[model samples]
Target: MSQTLISPGISVANDDKQRLGPRTRFGLLASITVTFLAGSSVPTPLYPIYQDQWHFTAMGISFIFSIYAISVLAGLLVFGRLSDYVGRRSVLLWTTVLQLVAMYMLGVADGFTDLVLGRLIQGVSTGAAVPAVGAALIDLNHKRGAVVNALTPAIGSAVGALMGSVFAQALPYPTHTVFAALAFILVIQGVGLLLMRDIRAKIPGAARSLIPQFSIPVDVRGPMIIASSLFVAGWAVAGFFASMGPRLIEQLFALPASWAGGLVLAAFAGSGVAAIGAFVTRSMHTLAWIGALGLLIGMAMVLVSLITGSLTPFVFGVVISGAGFGAGFQGGIRLVLSKSRAEEVAGVLSVAFLCCYLGMGVPAMIAGYAVASGHGIFDTAIVFAILVMSLSFIAVYRMISGGSRV
Candidate 1:
């Protein structure tokens, strides 16, 4: 009903509600951020079903999936620094609005094209919102960097995947139901965000902020590259999981209607959440080791499972590697944040995310094309692991060799 944008720097909370302390506010904001990210991957478990019903090939499926990464890349390249010039609340609120529109599109999707459109919009909304939301968490809690960002998205992805898969299996409408429920939840989150007070000071000239800058100041490049490396490795692995995982499960385990795919994804994200929580107060250096080791072990397990056609080893691999993914992501971000100025926080992180999603999207598209070209899934997956595994080693080497700041 209210169309007002709630101009920047103004408190939206009522006088009585303003009495709540900063910690409570942080928790609320963090929860909202998680909800925002959770919807990003809800469609993961449903991919196999789409393939069957829509008769889309592996490349088609990969194309639909990869579009999200591309759209997000575009958003980041353009609007990534927007939150730096605008207030965090304004950026975050706009993300919710965009998310709501994406969810509605997803809920009403009829064919493969609709799925493509839905994911495309979803990517843009998610990309624009994440930097701001991540910045807000760090802004609220100075000590929070990787742990908060890692834990929130991990929790969100896990819960969203698990819930979407469960509803698809149990509900009457399946896809429609999940999207509808998500839209409803986002509506609630949107209201909460609208009512929340702005925490950051608003800069003037936000209206004229249209240069499309991807600023990587000289001082921040080393940490940014290091972060980008880890992000590529982490998200490349995710590319395998999100794009090919269900089909992998179906072919190997013989469960074509695969909730196992979602479970594996959940395990990956949940383990990451757990690891970050356990080491919340620890240094990024420690998390880097944990991430590297976990990734190596996890990738090995995944290979073994694929080779043997066993589900147990695959589950073990996904869980362990997911911890690595979470750690690498957080460690990299935290490492960068340690070097970042307040004004440059969102922009720097946006570049980091751009690298990460490129890793997530591009490799998976290749894999999809690989499958479409009649390559054995196991062989293609092995190649993917080899590339990502090399990065893991590099991360470890850098972490230990005192070149970690790279």
Candidate 2:
């Protein structure tokens, strides 16, 4: 009964034979991941407030969002590779501290630069957290089922998005409260991380380093490319829903920010159910293509909503698009996890998330800039939806083609 945390690469394949209780570990890992990811969306419902108070345009909002995603990417590129070298709990503890810094900066910021800087820190925290948390889930897994690891992250992400919106709309301190609550959660996580039975520092060096680890090995390229494409498309749908959906609701449907928050919740709720269904039935890949089609239809729905100016269609579109996003994202994770060894799991998942956050960040920035330059929000939203649809279809085609070849 060794209590040391298992390092992915150390080849202790037989030396570490301890069995972590499935239910307890799953619960702990799920809570940690949900908390880590929830911080990303804490600012979603408040962007409009920033816009009004700061007199910043939509592009400014996109820049703000991009800072978070970019930091996440940087974390993935650098810290993700290290998770394979270090133990998972150590990375999670560091991530919690980084997240606290991000929340504190946002809470105390007095100007636009402060907001951007806070988001940048937030992105780094999220980047650090994802690989560590995702790897931890896989490490604890003893079940024959791989979907648990994949679905756990998706479920956690959706719950994070949902909770952030609910609290932002319902809580008293609109600007400061969410960050404060998140900071409190991080403190709890940091403590919990310390208490966890397995906290081994696998990588022995003079100092912990932060350097980007790139260069795909020849053998990993095919699956990695597939995983990358799947995430890019799946996350593009998420980006549109996050960045454009709010503006569309405010302008077209005349809904309050709270109502828009509800829409965001509905999207995540629907997607969460779909992901659970995938987990139960083991339909991750099968349902993924269907979700792609759902994305296509959802994109068309957005276009129609713009043309007809119907709130119902737009709301329905969000839910539909969300289902597609969840299925594809989770499914892609399943495909990669199925092929990877336990040691490589975190590195691959980190790459997938890097693609996902990038998809979510970059395109939204483009659309946000267009909106800032006097293009109608409706026009920007529609165009963004169309691009997502196209990219998703291409990914779907690749999945289908690869399946047929196999």
lDDT of each: 0.78, 0.68
Best by TM-score: 1
Judge candidate 2 at residue 244 and give its lDDT.
61
lDDT of 2 by residue, 309-365 (tens): 987787777767767666666667676666677766767777778788889889988
How far residue 16's Cα lies from its native spot in candidate 2, in Å, is: 11
Clashes (backbone N, CA, C under 3 Å), per candidate, total 0, 0
Model 1 TM-score is 0.91
lDDT of 1 at 216: 88
Q: What residue pairs clash in candidate 2, if any at all?
A: none
lDDT of 1 by residue, 144-241 (tens): 64467767877887887787679768777777888888888888767776767666656676755546676787877777666676788888887778
Candidate No. with top lDDT: 1
TM-score of each: 0.91, 0.88
Query: What is the C-alpha RMSD, rounded to one decimal, of candidate 1?
Result: 4.1
